[model samples]
Target: MSAGQVIKCKAAVAWEPGKPLVIEDVEVAPPKVHEVRIKIVATGVCHTDWECLYGTGKGMKFRPFPLVLGHEAAGVVESVGPEVTKFSPGDKVIPLFLPQCGECDRCQSPKTNLCKKNWANTQVGVLADGTSRISCKGQQVYQFLGVSSFSQYTVVPDTSLAKIKSDAPLDKVCLLGCGVSTGYGAAIKTAKVEKDSSCAVFGLGAVGLAAVMGCQAAGAKTIIGVDINPNKFAKARVFGTTECINPRDHPNKTIQEVLVEKTCGGVDYALECVGSPVIMTAALESTTDAWGTCVIAGWSETEAMNVVVEKILMGRTLKGTYFGGWKSVQDVPKLVDDYMKNKLKLDEFITHKLKLDQVNEAFDLLKSGESIRTVISLF
Candidate 1:
């Protein structure tokens, strides 16, 4: 049996920042206590992976080198470590970067999805035990955000994965691991979008489209999509965007002003999928001053931004979400079921399909805005 033994596998390794990931033979150690080894089936190329790849994840901060970067992926449980009673071999699962440990205070609370056992106590790139489980050419390789789905074989804590239905397609439901879940939940859960309410979504990326889809599902009447790129407008419409706006169309008026004018004051809800502080400000201002909610669903490289306090003083609410405010272990499975039942859209998000060898090309497509969600089939 492969249990208790190291597994040699192929993975896209980020040896250094600002360089393409090199396909390397990596040795993945067997799972430790309460951990599970995963045989990745299909993984989605997310923009966060790109952000982290360039060492610009949070802000202008440098990260450890030789890391495996990826979080959104679906796989089968290869082996279960000691005390891992929840999952077993052959179980279909999705690796979650935002883990939901059961006994944590945040996990018990209904207000936030951020967990306390999020490994802040440990080193930046190591597991909970204070060391990495991945190595390459006799050198240590760091795990990226705990999941490291770019690797062919990976180990994650029991709380770091969600078990999905057997019939759910790994290729499609993998989107739920990150982008889809983040965007959809931003609108449905965080923003608590009301039925027949007017909404505006910024960015028109995968997450933005997912938010639009969520608004549609919630019975939104007028959904406007805002983006700099006009190419994404058509796809935004398919995801229930009632109209589209390009910031370049109106040079004189600010984005928020344009949105406010369009909605005859402001939209009832606004979702920012782009991680720009400027866009976040626009999203906040483009909401109805009376009880309008703006959810920041994007990751910004700029650490902080100045906002108009009068906007909030006028009774508008501004909120932020990590991983779409989802309790990952519990809700991800339900999302997969939703996709399986055709209640959620997954196919439209997938613009390209490629093999593991073409991973750099996939990232290139993502970088150039040529593809939405590219599924890299490893099998």
Candidate 2:
């Protein structure tokens, strides 16, 4: 690959959310130093993509309109940046939206999910070095979540690319890149769920299902799932949820009381997977009287909550997680291995596989509760 090589390909552009994913021809530039080009196999359409589409009350930091939308994905490395050391052409890789510069203090620390310095550019939806590698009709199109796997090909930082075994199906493993990792990490890593513990998850989307699976793997004896959609219960149970609640069924019931009754007390851990502030309140209030942990794992723009702070006065801790508090460099591959070993349920989470042209339909299914995950099969 040379400097001026322009690889023309198809991409799903998000001119607006409710509008369809505009399909157009785009130019993917050759990889720069420390970057790699991937022929995307599949990309998972997640709620984060939806949020990025319709600016969730919290204004998007990434600039407006005429942008490619998507993040969660897996693919094969087609080329490498000049200085890239860890990967080569033909390697199977999963793109991490939050790239990590291994030498950064935050990456060195066990607590944070991101490498502060490496992400300065990705936050703006450009390449890490300050410019974009993808453009359309000569205009620099915004790269949503850095990877922009909505395209037939995507260029990502080497640090953002994790090499996985080629044997694993790209479609299933791609979900692990984002929602699965976020939800699983929220329960297994951030919350540090204990065996036989009582846990309640406040959403039943893909991430919520991943959390439920993580809670089960961590040996949680009681797993309660809360969701607005009653249809998610069957799927949640397959992911290890022991009980399910539809908010509609408890119209007059308080979230706290309902959870208390379900768990025989408050839950040992409560996970808020929905971005709503009201749900966050419910998560906090649903925890056990003391030594309970409430984890806010939802990607939301809501800031204020109707909270009674006293509910958490009894040694209950409110925690927030980013990518499940996972260190991508370490955890991503482990997740893949777990999936391959059948230790984690990956297949159950996927509800649809779509082509780039059908990307917007994927979002519609997500919003209408018609699908748990919609994967864009670029291959």
Pairs clashing in candidate 1? none
Report, for every candidate in turn, its global Cα lDDT versus the true structure.
0.90, 0.85
Model 1, total clashes: 0
Q: Give TM-scores for every candidate, taking all chains together and pairing residue i with residue i.
A: 0.97, 0.96
Give stretches of model 1 more than 4 Å off. 55-60, 121-123
Candidate with top lDDT is: 1
Candidate 1: residue 279 Cα off by (Å):
0.7
Give the true-structure RMSD of model 2.
1.7
- What lDDT would candidate 1 get against the real structure? 0.90
Could you say which candidate leads in TM-score? Answer: 1
Regions more than 4 Å wrong, model 2? 1-4, 16-18, 56-62
Please list all clashing residue pairs in model 2, or write none if there are none: none
